[model samples]
Target: MVRMFVNGQAMSGGSIHAPLTDARFLGRAWTAPRYRFWSFRDEFPGLEPVSTDGWSVPGELYAVSYAVLRERLLPLEPPELELAVIELADGSGSLSMRVRAEALAGAVEIRHPDGWHGHLATRQPG
Candidate 1:
């Protein structure tokens, strides 16, 4: 099984969390403090590597079998999101998804590393 850090709707109780149903939860994790985050219309979020400075995004880590990642998760992901190699706080590389550069051209940089969760928490019912 491979580890993936999910910081968006794939977390427990999130909208698109169905794909992780069979995956094993590995508790909470955070990224290295050198990445930026962006929100895509609040439906989901994206992460980008920033050399200068950034925050350590908080999220849930999961250990999923190779087949689940390659077949299920990847297939259900949106076009704007892509599997990315990220450096976790533990100094290891993991596969996750982030927004494409083109899609983030004018997107807002989430001020807080854990902004995604915070944003969603404050959302009102439509």
Candidate 2:
């Protein structure tokens, strides 16, 4: 199993969580305060590592089998995202998705202390 950090729809109760049905949820985790969070057309969250002035993004960690990672999760990812290693708040590395540099042109910066879920909360219709 490999550790995977997910900050968006792959989390619990999310639309894209089916792929992880067999994976082990490892509870909540945070990214090291060295990345910026983004939303590409409000479709998915993206992570961009920054040199300075970053914020911790809330997310979840899971122990996923190689088959799940390759055959299930990855195929659902958008073209704008690519798998990359990211540092957790505890300084541990885990595989996560980062926005491709080329895709930034269409991204909108998002600053929510609670991360993707928080952003989604605000977008709900009253």
Candidate 3:
């Protein structure tokens, strides 16, 4: 299983089984519209079981324009950060993500179709 140490906590997903240093663990981007979010999970079937263990969180999907995606995530990433493209499982397209060295901390703001915004934070260990 691929293990990612996000904020010192270990997160393993089926799609990632190699060491953290593996290139695969680098920036992996995935994008799905508000409609076909399930396809994202389907692409990496192996990750399903692991994804449920701790990484699973109820998150609503939003359709973000490519310009907005670049404006939000790319600018915040460090210079050394790697870029990965996560293609929406539903075949819509892909989103860009920057893999950081630090543990997965902070919250992600997702905008729903109805103009509602939700913030999701990483699961904290007890």
Candidate 4:
């Protein structure tokens, strides 16, 4: 099983979480403070690795089979995002999604303290 980090729709209770229902959830995890979290039209979130200014993004970790990664998970990913290896807060590596460099042209960079979920909360109308 490969450790996969999911910060967007594939996360638990997220729109695309159906594919991961049978996967073993490791736990909540954070990325190393070397990524820029972005929202693509608020449709989905993406992580961009940066060398200097970056933030730790929160997400869930799961142990999934290769088949799930290639079949269930990957195919559902947006074209603007790509698969990449990222460092976790614990200094370990995991498979995560990062925004394609070219795709950041109009994406909004998220600066909320809570990262993805925080951004989502702000989007909710009360």
**Candidate 1, superposed: residue stretches over 4 Å from native:** none
Error of 1 at 85 (Å): 1.2
User: Which stretches of candidate 4 lie above 4 Å from their native place?
Assistant: none
> Which consecutive 10 residues in model 3 have the weakest lDDT in total?
38-47
How many steric overlaps does candidate 4 have? 0
Residues 1-126 of candidate 3 have per-residue lDDT tens digits of: 221212111123322222232323333223333221111111211111122222322222333444533544335434433444333434433333323334223323223221111111222234
**Which residue window of length 10 is worst by lDDT in model 1?**
106-115
Question: How high a TM-score does candidate 4 get?
Answer: 0.97
Put down candidate 1 lDDT per residue, 1-126, tens digits, no spaces. Answer: 989899988888888788789999999998888788888877788888888877889888999988998887888777888998899998987888977877886667776645678877666577
Task: Report, for all candidates in order, the number of backbone clashes.
Answer: 0, 0, 12, 0
Please give the distance, in angstroms, between residue 7's alpha carbon in candidate 4 and its true position after superposition: 0.6
The TM-score measured for candidate 3 stands at 0.26
RMSD of each: 1.8, 0.8, 15.2, 0.8
Decide which is better by TM-score, 2 or 3: 2
